[model samples]
Target chain A: MATLEDLSKAVINGNVAKAKKLTQELVDAGVAPLDIINQGLIAGMNVVGVRFKNGEMFVPEVMVAAKAMSQGIEMVKPLIAETDMPSEGKVLLGTVKGDLHDIGKNLVGIMLESRGFTVIDIGIDKSPEDFVNAIKEHQPDIMGMSALLTTTMLHMKDTIELMKEEGLGHVKAIVGGAPISQDFADEVGADGYAPDAASAVDLCKSLLSK
Target chain B: METFNTTRSNFTRASFEVNQTIFWQMLSDDQCEEIFMTVQELLERTGVEILNEEAREIFEKAGCWVDGTRVRIPSPLTEWAARTAPSRVTLCDRNGKRALRVETTYSYFGPGQGNSFVLDPHTGERRKPVKDDVAATAVVCDALKNIDFVLSNGYPTDVKEAAADLHVFEALVANTTKPIIQYIPSVKHAQAILDMAVAVAGSLRELQKNPFFVYLIDADGTLVHSDETLAKVIFAAKNGIPFIYHTKLVLGETAPVTPAGTLVVALADVLVGVLLSQLVRQGTPVIAGGIFTVRDEENNMLPWGAPEVSLVGTGMSNLLRYLRIPSFGFAGASDSKISDAQMGLEEAFSMLHMGLSGTNLIQGCGLLESGLTGSLVMLVIGDEIIGMIRKIIKGIEVNEERLARGVIDAVQPGGTYLGEEHTLKYFRKEFWWPTLMNRNRIKDWTEAGSKSLGQRATEKTQSILQTHQPEKLSDDVLAKLREIIEKAEAAL
Candidate 1:
């Protein structure tokens, strides 16, 4: 009796336990793993995203919904093939060296995650070598560098140079921070720049499409 | 002189047992102390980047640590500057009458400056604002009972670019007698505008004694002071002109994203100007305030309507009140493109918040589209909103006479107190009558054409533009102002 509609409603309401239990029930009921993910979990997250965009839902509620959907996704992950698991893209995020600020970068990571992107945040005060090593390890589709200080923002350019030396030119590089403008992004040869967290999601989507 | 004396003590009471009016505060005493102490620590440790050499030398002479453009002031110097700055600054009208006592819990609402486009009064189309639009805004502000002062609402595009400030000052002084707050770009414009104010006051010393205008100088954010901003501060201080030292810290840009962190940067930005002014001339009348807001990530705009504006604006007002300095704030502004529901909601909430917080000078009356456009219609509607806010902030009286125990006893259980003398005596004083807002029944409202608030405001604006004539300057003063503008035009 645990239908996909009930699972979707649980995800929308951010009931993580209910979502996980329903996903398991649907799997036991012999429903396809992809069907439960597409119709139950992602369908609810799509509604959350729309509501957030329209200002009807706030950040915390969207975050909770994202958590609920991801919990449901974990229930179906082992049953489905890795290639069939839905994901927008893998994004690697870090705050540049000499800048300990991370609030903006963290917010960007949350926003990207809520939009179905796999965000790997390496935390703050990361140097160019750390970024290069993270890119090689995560092999993400896009790398984002954040810096709150003017002095540390220069490290974004250095990271881009090191990425080129490591022959990771195929991975798109994006930069953003309080002091980062589009002109500065262009000067540093970043693929794109976003002003704040919400735009960072859209920037990632556009870059991955290209 | 009589008006000046009475208006000075009008709102400020010598002493009161209980708070006489609605006293709203966002930050507690402990929080205020913490923020102020943190501001001092930030100033002493990080210091600010000063681009002006003379400013650095002034700080160095005052026993501050000056290493090139980085001048760090001791906390004692900052406390001394706060103590030295006058707690109250009085601004006079062009007719030499006190118009605003910029201090304490007294709040005055007015329009903002430098809107490039204006909502055309007749066609309702957005277009570039000209000098006549500036004059029209001044005239309308002069007629509005709640608008306490006037700011150049439009940056005149028709004027010469180099001398636009002088031209705007000329138009404002020519049209309105209310106290003017002018924005100056550089030291030259500051002196030129001061010369014009001197012309109106008849002499330099007279202008200094009762400045009809206050210079508004903005500081570059992120702990930096540009040379032009410093030069203007020096000019305003040396000439004994009262100036508002203002800055805007867009949350997460040019400042820390957190409200407390933004406050630290904001206080640092403003105190740097205050110290520089006081160092140039002790007891310089400097009002410190700024815009603390977040950039809309989606639209990439600094929204004037965001609730953070009220939160941070009230918080900053509380900080300035703690420091005992007159504060300024932004209110009655919106990111909406027109005079619609969003605009009304945004402006009403901000106006109410600023009024409740008792910000001394609340600007942004008619700003629209994130402060890119000005609308006289919006200004008219905002005046009505401010009138309502003023009544709300007046609070209630609980004395015996106001309690009306005797009147209630005499009236007895719904026996038509409308006919009583007590009712006749207290009705007008107890009520706030709306001019534009309708309180009529549906039938009556429909019979009267059932106009929306926007339509009513537009009509009121057109009527004011048609008939409201501001107090004029003397022929001699007018000629002198014209001559100064011409000279600046030629020189620049």
Candidate 2:
């Protein structure tokens, strides 16, 4: 009796166990793995995303809903092949060197995850070396650097330079923060800039499509 | 139809100009009445010192305890003052047109008067402000939409120290047609400034109906007033000059440590001012005004933006509401040395707090470094903040047109309403669009060059300075004003 709509509601309510159980039931009922992943899990997260953008939903609620979506995805993962997992893209995310501010960066990561992008958060105060290593190891489609301070944001340019020198030109550069702006992004040779979390997901998707 | 009244055949037609103010008070009606009662008791029991012979005679004639300059006013006299003072006060612009209709708690915001220094936009240094600085400040205020009136920001160090006020007054009067609330140091200076204003008005009778400036006088601290303070009151009352009688109470220093004790002292100070002004002439337009702030014991400094100041403002507003007089409080000010993050946070809190506390006229805009310096950049950004607060005060409407029930139904179940007719009908009015604050996409912002909010504010100030020109005083009027000042200099 557990339907895909029930799974979507569970994800929207941020009920991880209910979401996973309903997703498993949908899998057992022979619903296509891609259909449950899109029509159920991502469908629920899309509502949360829109609500957050409209200022109706807040970050804690978005984080909780994202957790439920991640759990639901885990339940439907085994039925789908690795190459056909339906991820929009992989993004390596971090707060750039000398900047410990990560609340915005974490919100951006969760938003990307909810939008079907795999977000690998290397945490705050990341060095250019750490970013380069992560780019080589993860081979992420996008590299995100955030800095909330003026002194630390200079490292954004350094990390972008490392990416360029390493010949990882396919990995697009993205930057944002309290003091960061589109002009700063262009000056540092970043591919895109996002002022806030919801827009960060959109920025990654648009950049990946190109 | 049945007859509605016995004396009159039909009920009178009801008509009134719409007063769009979101009225709010932090105290209840009973509590507000209690503050007035406390003020009366303090006046009747603990006598106030009236430092002028004429002022003391008026108090004594109204049954106050007179011992030298110390006079204890009776409760009846204080009540008489509240009853006699005009319930409505109007502010007229330089063109003799009514601008601010002040009788209720409809908040109007403007910068402060007589800042000794101004922040130079070009050099980014705090320097002594001159006459040009006053004109520049007035022009910026004229350009700002939220700034309803002008006040002399610069003390004009270039002018003679004995006549700095006149220079400031002339500079402000020259630059903006907006009504001003500023000071004249003495009774003689008040007359000279009025003469200048009258010259600009083309006649004495025209100046009477359209006094473009309001007088501000200090009641000092508890139970003490200077002679000139009372003299200004008499001049303003007899001449029909609108005035605000105010005091600055510093808790644990000039007043008691507790807010209640300080409130009582402040209330008595303003009441005595009102009583004196009313005694001079009935129906005198007067505002019951005071600023109450406690020193930060930990830091040993006056926290102008402290929450305690807002509390005092709220309590005083409640008292004035019950007394049926206008309220004035401080807002859009900061303790920070610069217009940085701290300035933004503090000013936003103060402006919104005082705006919601039912003040009719709010001051202290563009003030920073604890009211020591005035910055045009901060004044411009303060406009953006007040505009945002205005949107908050507008709130959300839940009626049929605002609710957009049909639009919601149409967009239900994963439908977007971005292209809907309802959206077009309401978005511009409902949403508060920022004029200076950036909301551009990162690529565009980076393309435009990453600018901070401070930089943006500075740029706006620069642009206004370059483009915005104010109405000028006529050549003959200027000559007449200078002549009046010359006469005052020869006499005083």
Candidate 3:
């Protein structure tokens, strides 16, 4: 079986091929896919993410590690799917109506998913009804909205009001975008505010625990 | 109706009769007190300018340095220093309105985003800005009151029609009660705009009255010589408009590694522009311009902000202020962070120091993500911050009236000041209520659906666009502007 150091280096160095090969070797050697995934790929990615947070690694390094993690995910997605893989929580996410910009929302989704949240992304320009429908259908623990344009971020308030009027206010709401703030979230009756993608994940996790 | 001149207006268009003393000035009572306090605090506590040996020496000799962060200069010398600084400038466009009393100490400029240039849904490739774009851009310039002047977004594309573009910008800008820094490129184009400005002002006296303007160096902060500089100098001298020398310094991939070396190189380029400006327009204001950005290890321009940039920005601002020349620097900007955190932190920190250091033009208002993009929401946020800083600059009033002597007398018995006539008279004037910043209770906020600042600003922007239609032009003026644009486009 490949040592943790080998797997660690492969992930940190962003060597997707090496990581895949190492995973196969571990699997062939009778090591469980769970161990390889949990202690190897995920653990390695955790390290990469930490490094990125501390500024020890920049965007390119983080990107490379993300690539390696994705390759490993591709190998294990079916296996994990078959076994009802553990997740942090369920989140319903979408950009508010009239707002098409998605970079901020996409970042939040990726970061949440990376943290093991089963994210049901409702896509951009989703109206309040769309969010309510998704929440009812999915029964998500939390609903998140994103908007980038000042013009469209207004829709977040409308969505929140609509959600309340339509009996969906019981679902915890989180809002983020270029212009959204703690004050704005509070103003819109959102349960919490996440300033960035990383913060959103942490906030989601905290909300779940509560 | 009250006479226009009697009104307490921010729009003050006045000039000095050479050698006439306006002794009501010096540092102005408020400026002197603040500077003295700042200097004393800086000198007593921190030994100001210890890093720069030359500045340190100067400080030690002229200031009573108590510490690195504080220094005290005598009031008379402080007044002399303040008097040497350039105060008001005017930014004029073609259609009769020119933003006057525009503080040239600091200003900002940047373009809108790439994909969102055209508002029309059906436009193919962001149709090259026609007359409508010019008119819209002019309104935008007016709305962006923090921007001291105008910069060319796409090249104006016409040497002869430069006058008309200037007219559109000036007409729209007439709404703003601030100065206009005319951004010109080629010499011929510069001449065209200047001629138009002169024609619009109606006389040399009107131009002289608001003579504080800029024939800005359009060399892209590089050393490349261009004919625009020559035209600018000639027009500035002939019409008495000031000149702002600009140089942009990009570090990491563009320049040296060390921040100091980058600053020196940038300063040298600025000095070249300054000298050229002075050579062309004697006694005109020559300002230091350009932004310092960097490329990180990934070569992605690394979020566009560096601490070194701020430090250098402050240092250069102080340097120019001391040298008796006006300067400009990036004030309200951020790297890649797009949220309120980015806006709050970047806008306050960047502009605060520049304003404190007394840089003449601190641009970068309403800009975000390292000046790569802009948001109307961000601009409103910056404006609120500017209001706060203006309060800071105004400082506290410790006079008897402010001390509430009469109110104390009347309320000697247990009573409230809130119900007093004095309170009623002054409360509104004293408070700076932000348009979008909600300070209401959570219940009230939620009842209103807790709209974000962006949401509120969007509504405000729409309302302004819809209701506050600016003063319109006559058919004759419209036809003239169109003819000018048509000829220019045809040639292009």
Candidate 4:
């Protein structure tokens, strides 16, 4: 009999085909859907999260593991309702105008996504209007802007102002850049600033709690 | 062929050759003499311009022909100067206690000087460092046990233009008791700085007898000496003050493209320098070094982190050892913009070479972007890296006590040693401990903050700045130094 532990080991190994097959096999063997996701996929992800946090597992490994979990979720979601699939929160991320630097921004996006947030990425060199439009469309819990240039970081403030003007100011604004500081974030009306990608995940968790 | 010898001492480890733990050599006696003779040939054939007229007159008095400002010395004069120079120098703390005794193959490190931008540890921004940054740098240097001495750690741009050098030195004196390597711009400024040192030492001749500071001068590549630089060199030599004279040779630009060719030019530059210092005042303490750089068409950057540069630096250090003189070289620096893998690898390899090659007075710690940027976090990492190298250089002990023959006998086959007395006695001393590198398990690391090495370095810098107060100078001495600076300010 296939067990949820087998499904978890498959997911931990980042074997997407094996994970989906084992998860289906567990379901056919009369295991509950919640047992497969909560005990198998989520349990595997929890270990990966701890390892990533500890610097034991790098981004590529966790990313592959996350892919397996997502595929397993695709098989398990139809059988469950919205109440079982727990979404942590939503995050909107973009690199502001005149800055083509997006490697760090994309790392933050992956960090947020892997932590259970539904991240909406607006891509690089995005203007204030692009962020404002994405915010209106996604209505995300947190809006994060990244800039590598000192000149391009001003667009973060402009986007915050547009959010205020549109009466969507309840969304928390977080800023990050190579040149960004917490004092600069406060001066520009951002609620948080993270110096690196991993801290961006902590910033999201802490901000969402408030 | 390679040879290995093992010896034992019961109480302490066996002393290696010359009673040192490790030894590494590059240049031999024949090569040393060849380089010295080459320098003599270069000076006589292709002369250096003794830019100052007084220096030119001194060279002429010593039987050197002068064509305008350029002067050439004879092989006999070069041999005399090299022979007459003192082989050792001892530097002292501000309180007049001997702190550093410098001679062959003894390496120490401190921060380099003259950076326009300092990375704010708190905000990670690049800004012009002020007098307060100098204070912070000195206090941190005081707390770092690995850094043997201090320097005018950065260029403070916010002070009065004429008094900036003194202001930086004052901050250094106030915050740390470590001997300083200072830069005095002119003879007038050197006089003021000398007066300040006299006040600290309580007399001029006493300060000369046990100098608390060493001044430095710059040379423009090979055989290009500026007048002010030469003047400072002469002043130091005359007053029996320790002086470091160095030149930056950018390969393919200021020097030959190949490492060997660049080394030839560098030897010509530094040997000529040492020869001149000895001529000014025999038995004067002079430290010679070359900050060698490499530039190819594919990689035209100032390759401070390149293997080619390290090769030349190691060769120069070996040559200095053969000459029985203290040497200056570089380690623990990088051209990367952050404290990333590139910075770590470059610093680790360069530090290994600097250790094995026996380069005394290693500088360029905490420097980034090839000396254009400074970071205190990098300094913290440098302190750790040097500690590791020093541990490696301590080598292994093979004595019967260290071998633990009795303990091994007591523990039977397939038995454990974790519960034995031998483990408890030697584990801490045998292990190489790290302060910043993380060694935590995954869960524990996640529970704590998941911090990077840069973040850890920044936190360490902040705590040291806030809590570490160095030994201070008396109020009267501070006031006297200020008065001397005021006098120099008037002159300027």
TM-score of chain B, candidates 1 onward in order: 0.96, 0.93, 0.66, 0.93
Residue B263 of model 2 has an lDDT of 78
| Model 3, runs deviating above 4 Å | A1-210, B1-134, B140-178, B203-213, B220-239, B252-261, B302-307, B337-340, B405-415, B473-475, B486-492
lDDT of 2 by residue, B247-360 (tens): 899988899888777878888888888888888877778987888888888888887777788788777777887788887788887889897999998888988988776687
**Model 1 chain A poorest 10 in a row by lDDT:** A55-64
User: Which model scores highest in TM-score?
Assistant: 2
Of candidate 3 chain B, the 10-residue stretch with the lowest lDDT total is B18-27
> How high is each candidate's TM-score?
0.68, 0.69, 0.50, 0.67
Ranking by DockQ: 2, 4, 3, 1
The residue-by-residue lDDT of candidate 3 on B261-316, one tens digit each, is 55545554454344433333344555565667666567556453456566667656
* Superposed model 2: Cα runs more than 4 Å off: A1-210, B1-23
Is candidate 2 or 4 superior in TM-score?
2
- The positional error of residue B284 in candidate 3, measured at the CA in angstroms, is 3.2
- For all candidates in order, the CA lDDT equals 0.87, 0.82, 0.57, 0.80
Task: Decide which is better by TM-score, 2 or 3.
Answer: 2
- Model 4, docking class: incorrect
DockQ of 4: 0.01
Model 1, residue B183: C-alpha shift (Å)? 0.2
Against the correct fold, how does model 3 do in TM-score? 0.50
Q: Which ten residues in a row have the lowest lDDT in candidate 4 chain A?
A: A55-64
